[model samples]
Target: MQIYKVGGAVRDRLLERPISEVDWVVVGASAEELLAQGFRPVGADFPVFLHPKTGEEYALARTERKSGRGYGGFTFHASPEVTLEEDLLRRDLTINAMAEDAGGRLIDPCQGQRDLQEKWLRHVSPAFAEDPLRVLRVARFAARYAPLGFRIAPETLALMRQLAESGELQALTAERSWKEISRALMEPRPDVFIRTLHDCGALRELLPEVDALFGVPQPAAHHPEIDTGEHVLAVLRQCAEHAQPLAVRWACLLHDLGKGMTPAEEWPRHIAHERKGLKPIRAVNTRCKAPRDCQELALLVGEYHSHGHRALELRPSTLLELLQCFDVYRRPQRFEEFIAACEMDARGRLGLEQRDYPQAGYLRGAAAAVRAVTVQPLLERGLEGAALGEALKRERLRALETYKAEALGEPSDPPETPRP
Candidate 1:
């Protein structure tokens, strides 16, 4: 039997990057042979075994053909007769189709080496056009390789655009779409790749809620984009502009997604958009396989202005009371992300005045500043765990008492005593 390393392990090794996992394809080997060699057997679709020692996956060499549609539509066949070339021919892209033997002899049956050398991401065969999920995969590849200066070939892009326009993208699962998006967001210029998805139409299929936001108008007092969706993406960029956690950044991306579907009457406001925004975003969390609590921080950011606006009229104790409401969200960075969202939301409006772009926390610097003033007292109180949490509720109320009138044009109130 011949053993060859395949997929990401090979790709990472070629790039001189850290290799996290190694996958192998064993040709001319039967399941019994693998078992004899101490590989553990588990084959639901195709023959895949785990190394008895390291538990790494090793699949028997196999070939596939499209049996129907979408990603799960493939049918595989393997025999003692199949060649390695037969297997590589079915890969989605040239760069990923290359394989390396145990001794590191490079196999280039698909011209993948040429594409890798040229920093290109090109499809391996015409079969790439059969699966719409490839559209998302290519976009993710562009994001991963963009910082390294790789580009997709013109013809490959043409095929992707065709797939996108034919509504083939709709067949992709929410889980699959989100996986690519999560990877793309981790890249240096996710917008570069995400914008390409919009042009290709995959964005419309996977994020119709957000797509509907593209041109929706904001009240002239707030956004320049005419829609909350653009504002959210811009804000999402700002959140990731730093080395923030993926959850916070993703929350920022979807902060106002609820506004698209829940249009406000009486001219044009989302009427507590944050609260309304959470229901659909929660649905997204459920449908897209996002963490159940991912929505918590995003909802916190969303509700802040609306809630903060109302919190203004309350005393510090009352404001603290409102702060208690946020305990369910629980992200340490929730307040900071909230301010960042506000800043981006404000700056996104068309014809934003200096007043509109209030010299305060809708942008991160101001948000940080407000956080410092608000958070310092809580930190200084020497509260730990539960005490610290309870203190934060009071501290937030104190800040609301401090900034409410200044920021939201809401009525002001005096501060109140902190809990002992």
Candidate 2:
């Protein structure tokens, strides 16, 4: 059997990128022969094995036929007769369809190298439309390679639009859809992913809540971009520019959902939008089956991002409540992510990308000051049970008050006397 390196390993190698994993396509091999040679079977739907020594995946050269719908509706045919060119033809993109032999000779039956050299992301064949998942994959590749001056070929984008209009996207499972979305959000230009999907009409099918924001108006004074959709895209760009984590980027994307629900009569004003956003945030979280951390942070940012923006102006009690809601003492990292999302929102407005966001530092300081209030002191004072809980609350409040006063350069309020 002849084994050849294929897919992303070959593509990234050609682009001089850091290769993370290697996959192999074993042509002229049968399942029985691989099992006899010590490769461990791993694939459930097709013939894929793990190398006994290297543990990397080795899939038999195969061809696929579209049998049903969505991502899983496919029948595979793998045998000793399957050619390397036949296997490559079933791939999604031309760049990803090329392979390399054991001797490092490039195989280019699909003209992938030519497309790569021209900085074009073109489809290998019309079979690209068979799998709905390719729409997300192509958009993700756009996000990854856009920095290198790559653009999707117009014909490929037309196929993506066709897929979006075919009602096939609705059949994608939440888990599969979220996998592509979360990965795309972490790419260097995640905004390009969303924009590409929007251009192809997939955004409305897959993320209608976000799609609704496109034409919504916002106050031009606060959001110089004026369009809620553009503002969200700008926020995503900011998150990518700073290399923010996935949770922060996810929160930033959904933080402004309520703006889309605003009445046109309200025009640029969206009063109480922070509270209004909670429903759509939960809807999106449920639909995407987002991880617990990502969903929790998105909900928090959506419901209270305005509070974060108004950090310096909030009452001491309000600030303390906000900190408690975030469970800052137990999950300080999540609190930091929440603030990062808020900062991105504040900076996303047109002509204000570099403006300072003091709210993040202010909130961090408040969390630190409150966390410094120890239960040990109350325990030393003979406090126990409900009294201890009340004492701890009062202490934390007093600490927050002091911190706020200090941060704002104002006189501190006198601590309240404890009840007997």
Candidate 3:
């Protein structure tokens, strides 16, 4: 049997990018033969084996035919007769269809190298439309490589648009779609992913909540970009530029969903959109089975991002209420992520990218200021039960008031003591 490294490892190596993992394809070998050689059989639907020593995956070269629909609707054939060219031809993208031999000889039966040099994301065959998930995969690949100047071939883009209009995207499982989305959001140019999907008509099918924002207008005074969709992309770009975590990036993505629902007569004004966004944000979270932290933070940002921007001007009581809502004393990390998302939103506007976001620092300091007030001191003062809770609240409120004064550059005014 001849083993050759295939797919991403070869593609990334050729692009001079760091290779994270290597996949091997064993040609001219049967599953029984590999098992006899101590390769562990691990694939359930197809013939995939684990190396006896390194444990890297080694699958027999195979080809597939569309047997049904969606991502799971496929029939596979793997045998000693399947040629490496046949296997590579079935891949989704040309750049991912190349393989390498043990002697360092390159295999490019699909002209993957030529496509890579041309910075094109071209499909290997027309059969690419057979698998609906390729729409998402192509968008993700665009996100990953767009920073390197890669663009989807017009012909391939037409194929993608056809698949998107085929009504097959709705058949994809929520978990699988979220997997592609989360990965794309973490890429260096994730905005390209959204724009690519929208350009090919897949965004409307898969994420209508986001697509609706495309033509919606925003107040130019605050958002010079005017279009809410453009603002969302800008936020995603800022998140990536800052290297923010997945939770923050996703939050920024969903932060303005409510703006899409605003009345046309209310053009350029979306008052209360923050609270109005909670439903769509929750819908997205529940559909994707997003992690609790991500869901909670997205909801928090959607409901309070405007509040975050107006932080310095809020009443001391309102500021305290905001901190209490986030439970900043208990989950400081979540509050920090909330601040990061808000910062991305504030900086995402046109001509505001490099502008200061003092709200982030102000809110962070507010959280820290309250966190510095402990219940231990109250407990030491012979306080207990409801009285102890009351004392802690008062102390924290007092601390926030002082912080507000400092942030506003005003004289410190001590809060009145609560009667016990």
* lDDT of each residue in 1-420, candidate 2, tens digit only: 999999999999999999999999999999999999999999666799999999999999999999999999999999999999999999999999999998999998889999999999999999999899999999999999999999999999999999999999998999999999999999999999999999999999999999999988887667778889999999999999998999999999999898888899997888888888899999999999999999999999998888888888788889989999999989999999988988898888889898778777889999999899989989999999999999899999999888887888853753211100
lDDT of candidate model 2 versus the reference? 0.91
Provide the TM-score for each candidate, comma-separated.
Answer: 0.74, 0.96, 0.96
State the C-alpha lDDT per candidate.
0.67, 0.91, 0.90
Ranking by TM-score: 3, 2, 1
Could you list the CA RMSD of all candidates, in the order they appear? 7.5, 4.8, 4.5
Write the residue-wise lDDT of candidate 3 on 1-420 in tens digits.
899999999999999999999999999999989989999988667799999999999999999999988999999999999999999999999999999999999999989999999999999999999988999999999999998999999999999999999999988999899999999999999999999999999999988999999999987777889999999999999999999999999899999999988999998888888878889999989988888888999999999887888787778789888999999877889889988998899888888788777778888999999899988878889999999988988998899888877676763752211100
lDDT of 1 by residue, 100-165 (tens): 997889887888877888998889888889898888889878867777889889889888988888
List runs of model 2 lying over 4 Å from the truth.
410-420
Model 2 lDDT at residue 214: 93
Q: Runs in model 3 with CA error above 4 Å? A: 411-420
Where is model 3 poorest over a 10-residue stretch in terms of lDDT? Answer: 411-420
